[model samples]
Target: MKNIIEELFYGNIDTQARGFKKDSYLQKQIMIMSNSEEILTERLKGDDKKTFLSFVNASGIVLGESELDSFIVGFRLGARFIYDTFVDNITPYDDFLKEVNNEG
Candidate 1:
């Protein structure tokens, strides 16, 4: 099984919702959290935005939350089975490691 962090940037980590902009910190957090099933979101049900996506990656049921609920963070991609190129061993983790500006 490939690492979840690798999958995400490799386009493996899919989400039903993507309106949320991809943040470096958020990506790292998601990658680490991928080890488990549950994920706490930074977005909310309705604050001052339009209809949002119900899920993200691997379609899962949301438990619900005031700030952000457990969003889907995984899904089986058809490309991996159908195409060899899709199943890239050189995952996003490699890229992340290279350009990781660890300055906060």
Candidate 2:
């Protein structure tokens, strides 16, 4: 099997394709959002419909940017965790928690 990094680099992995579970909160919310969008699109007319679509498109762009930022931050956080595990010599999570809580 190829390495995960190579798989990702070669476009074999699609992280975003792992969607929410059926009947999950996120799934329910996505359904609600889709229904609301359909209803709103049907109701609006002329310039109002155009404006609504433009707003939605702009919001999608902003959300995509935010998702990218969050992914970068989360990746850095995980890297830092591994770096800390090796450099700080705090092997046990319970000890780390105790130190954080000033119980040590």
Maximum-lDDT candidate: 2
Model 2: CA > 4 A from native: 87-104
Q: What does candidate 1's lDDT look like per residue over 49-93, in tens digits?
A: 222234443244333442243232222344455465755566544
lDDT of 1: 0.49
Q: Give the Cα error of residue 33 in candidate 2, in Å.
A: 1.2
> Model 2 TM-score?
0.73
Cα misplacement distance, residue 14 of candidate 2 (Å): 2.4
Compared with the true structure, all predictions reach lDDT values of 0.49, 0.89
Candidate topping TM-score: 2
Report residue 31 deviation for candidate 2 (angstroms): 1.4
For residues 13-58, what per-residue lDDT tens digits would candidate 2 score against the true structure? 8878887888999999989999998999999999999999999899
Every model: Cα RMSD to truth: 19.4, 7.7
Residue 38's lDDT within candidate 2 is 93
